[model samples]
Target: MQSNDGPAIDETSSSSSSSSSSSSSSFSSFSSSSVTVTITKLTTNKRKSMLTVNGYEFHFKDYNKAKTIKFLRCASRNCGILLHKSFSDEFVRFSGKMTDHSHLPNTAALGIRTLREKLRQRAEHERLPLQEIAEQEVRAGLLTGHNLLHNRRKLMPPLPQSCDFNIPDEYRKDYLNRDRLLLHDSYDPQFQLHESVYKRPEGRTLVWSSDVQLKLLFDSEKLYMDGTFCTAPPNFNQVYIIQVIHHETFKLYLFH
Candidate 1:
């Protein structure tokens, strides 16, 4: 004999899904050709999962799939839009939020927000040059080249701008004109800075190869560097030497 009774299926569980179609069709057009959008963080707090997807910001609403299925709600108190995003194997899809925005988006706000978000996204321990990032924007055509320095400053944190109340206007002008050299100066025309290394500070640590045996300099391995106080000339108390051995011939070439 068999029982006719069956396990009850909770209607509430089934109602959780908003779509009636298969999951494939539901996610196929998440970021379709018509959508030109970017996801940016709305806050710095890690626990408070607030993000702006294509200019529309939303706050965390729920957690699923080990907290990967991020369900979010519009941050604006007046707005009731909900957002759906998933990450398993790859991005499943993003949906639920309306793309229309109420306020007019200005260039200054967008520029500052993008820069700040970029700096925040980078690992806190990594060496990043904020000023250099600003300059690169001009080269990349994100900002105009005519007012290069002013545009660069806009991209960087305006610490100097707030603190430079006592600084002479002329000094600020000088910074605008030549400060680009501080992070990017090389006496040797042959050796150029890597494009990735757009920013560095003004300091004595920066150096380069110079002089005889220089021909073999680029061709060598096992480069050696040492400084001697005892053997240096009177005018030069400390003399540093860099020597390298040829890769093929195994000949040592010394350069001071």
Candidate 2:
């Protein structure tokens, strides 16, 4: 028999109590597992900070803040395929070191002298005109000498004065006389003929043709004449006489 002060427990109520206890235990296990995962995350981040590749230490501080590494195919003409990519800093440093002045060959020091000697020999072998080669040699010698003199602290000589000699009276008189004779000799009869033939008319005259038929008719009968003149003794005057011939009889008539 049941006691009067206590409530009787049902099967369903007992099962419900067991399920709630199981759920509480599972929740505690999950929380503890999360703590271990957070520790692993921290360790992984620390390892990442010490990462290295191909024996080169990764120093982010040496790089500019805005700089970024690019993955480009190798740009060498012989190896354009994607061999590797590099940071711009490393590439620029490598290029600059390769092109440093100390890397130049020893022969480059005497390059100009060697080139000049070779050219001189070649010019001689080809039997080129000596004057041209001499001029070139003189120019090269002058430039080389100037450079040497400048390096030694020597001053250049002053240029020659342009006005050095006085003109003699007899020479000046001969030059003037020769020029006057040349001028007098150049005034020939042919120039006089051209001047006479192409003289400007005394006054301007205007002739207008109206109709096409009339123009054609006048042009059919039109004649052209030309003549030449020669200089006379007393004066420079010359004359040219021009005549138009009649179309029917070919008789010449002086044009007004």
Range of the 10 consecutive residues with the lowest summed lDDT in candidate 2: 16-25
lDDT of 1 by residue, 96-171 (tens): 3354434333345434555554545443444668566645544554646667888777875444322112323333
User: Which portions of model 1 miss their true places by more than 4 Å?
Assistant: 1-29, 32-49, 64-68, 88-110, 119-256
The clash count of every prediction, one per candidate, is 0, 0
How many Å off is the CA of 122 in candidate 2? 9.9
**Alpha carbon lDDT at 225, candidate 1:** 72
Question: TM-score for each prediction?
Answer: 0.29, 0.15
Per-candidate Cα lDDT values, in order, are 0.43, 0.28
Candidate 1, residue 75: CA error in Å?
A: 2.4
- Candidate 2 off by > 4 Å: 1-135, 143-147, 151-256
